[model samples]
Target: MSTAISEAGNIPVNAATPVVTYSPVVFDVPGRAAPLEIKVSAPATGTDLPIILLSHGHGETNFIASLHGNAPMAGFYAAHGFVVVQPTHLDDKALGLRDSGHPEAPMFWRSRVTDMHFILDHLDEIEATVPGLAGRLDRDRIAAVGHSLGGHTTSMLLGSRVDDPEDPQTGDLSDPRIKVGVILASPGVSDEPTDGVMMQRVRMLRFINFDTMTTPALVVAGDKDLNENFSTRLSYRSDAYTHAPAPKTLLTMHGAEHIFGGITGFDTVETTDEDPERVATLRAMIWAYLRSALYPDDKAWPAAVEALESGAATSSGTVESK
Candidate 1:
């Protein structure tokens, strides 16, 4: 392992400023079945810290699918100079909305996008909720990151749109506030289940259009993330990178699975491929990508890529860009 890519890729972790986390910062949204809940994590001391809006996946685990999930990712980003905020979308398993007869039951795709916008709209309030965090965030340099279904949410925030048949108002839901994004193990543009089980299962996925996803992003997929419940196509998850326009990067992790080495939570049963080292390196890569994307002059992305290619970071993955 090379010290070239410090603990957090190009950004070295400072032992002086420890990580701090606060949770359940509630917000009442009209028309929403339940109040919105969020968790925030950041360094104890930092000014003008960049922001990362982390969206959790709709996983099998109860708490990991909500604001309490992705501790590995949120901790890494926060420890390495980024203020991370996570929202518990309406589809959270703990909410039990799947059988509520709501039109967007199960996935609640549109509300997921709305939650991100609501977070951005009320950053001031969110900041005040956490002690010593007010006026320390760089509002202009915010990025969105999502895993699995949350990946679709991040893509939507980055410009991906859905032409939903059930919802005629499903127009462009892209937000200019999000400068860049990371999509991990998310569904791709596929017609494999044209009229099959998946079409009737996750119907919204059938209409996901990446033609207009023009924002810059990094799409990550595992070589072994084959879930029979979804499409069996090996390239199904990486299609977001394949179909999206230029200014995108794809990171294919060797031997990794849907959880990308246990990103949802530490030692959780949801992660079939539970390798801590893989999780650490993946965190570094994501941190580097977000840093470089937010600051064009930053050399973190290229340095991290070089480290990975040179076997300094690890031999577990390969990176390609358009």
Candidate 2:
């Protein structure tokens, strides 16, 4: 990875440390159609480290939609003192279920949310599975982070309920175990017009409600990411931060796109906006936010907010918290 100096003229914490990764850690979910598989990554050496459960975005790219994607963020988080866990959701194209008559086809949004809970339920198995990782985790400190459809999953875990369109009843998938969340380029409002196959397949998108998303979260949106297909207005993507209650933050990247500088993978074609500096800023700010949120007495989040307000970080983005 290329290194970029932060406002303090030093390498960011994410890039300064090294990490160890273990993949294909299998865990069984009783009654689920298939077993859940995950990839775990952590700092080479650290005790009492926090945990970050990352969910990958849904797309046609089979591998990327699984735990294999988001290496950039996973590695960064792992290197910077967090044990990152990524799961391969049922919606992944790699399973070749598109043509099959599966019940939860297309988005499988509900299953995605449950996948996270399953991971949490089996943390003991995860620790035992990973060599040299037992007793090194801080179980009480846990956070969920996601992108795109995965962000929707994370939101549900953070108390965003979905109203069952047919039943008029809401589903509460929120997990009290998840202390904080971070949403990257997730769909907002869901008021956009739809037609053709997308209208029929992704009907669950309309029921997403952020009014009850009271969890402390950091919502990151790209100013230039005009996802017209998802919403009529670009600002619609910022609904997570806009609709959620206090203790929420919005980080608007000045000139970023959906991928936010190749966060899905290193130097991949999906990254429309490739700015190393912007990615570096994200690394520093997210690390700071996670640290401060997990440890209330920590001042990293406040100091980073001050830096952003004072034009100390080259004005890469604007931060607003409430």
Each model's lDDT comes to: 0.87, 0.82
Output the TM-score of candidate 1: 0.94
Model 1 Cα lDDT, one tens digit per residue, 111-142:
99999999999999999999889999999999
Model 2 Cα lDDT, one tens digit per residue, 1-322: 9665442212223344678899899877886657788999998897999999999998778589899998878888888889999999988889776556776777778888999998999999999999889999999999999998898889899988777668443578899999999998887766655522343457776667898998899999999887655666788668899988888999998898988876788777777888766676776778789889999998878787777666667547888889
Stretches > 4 Å off in candidate 1:
1-16, 193-196
Q: Pick the lDDT winner.
A: 1
For residue 74, what is the lDDT in candidate 1? 93
In candidate 1 the C-alpha lDDT for residue 296 amounts to 94
TM-score of each: 0.94, 0.92
C-alpha root-mean-square deviation, each candidate: 3.0, 2.7
Error of 1 at 145 (Å): 0.2
Scored by lDDT, model 2 comes in at 0.82
Stretches of candidate 2 off by over 4 Å are 1-15, 167-170, 192-200
Q: Given candidate 2, what's the lDDT at residue 189?
A: 68
lDDT of 1 at 60: 69
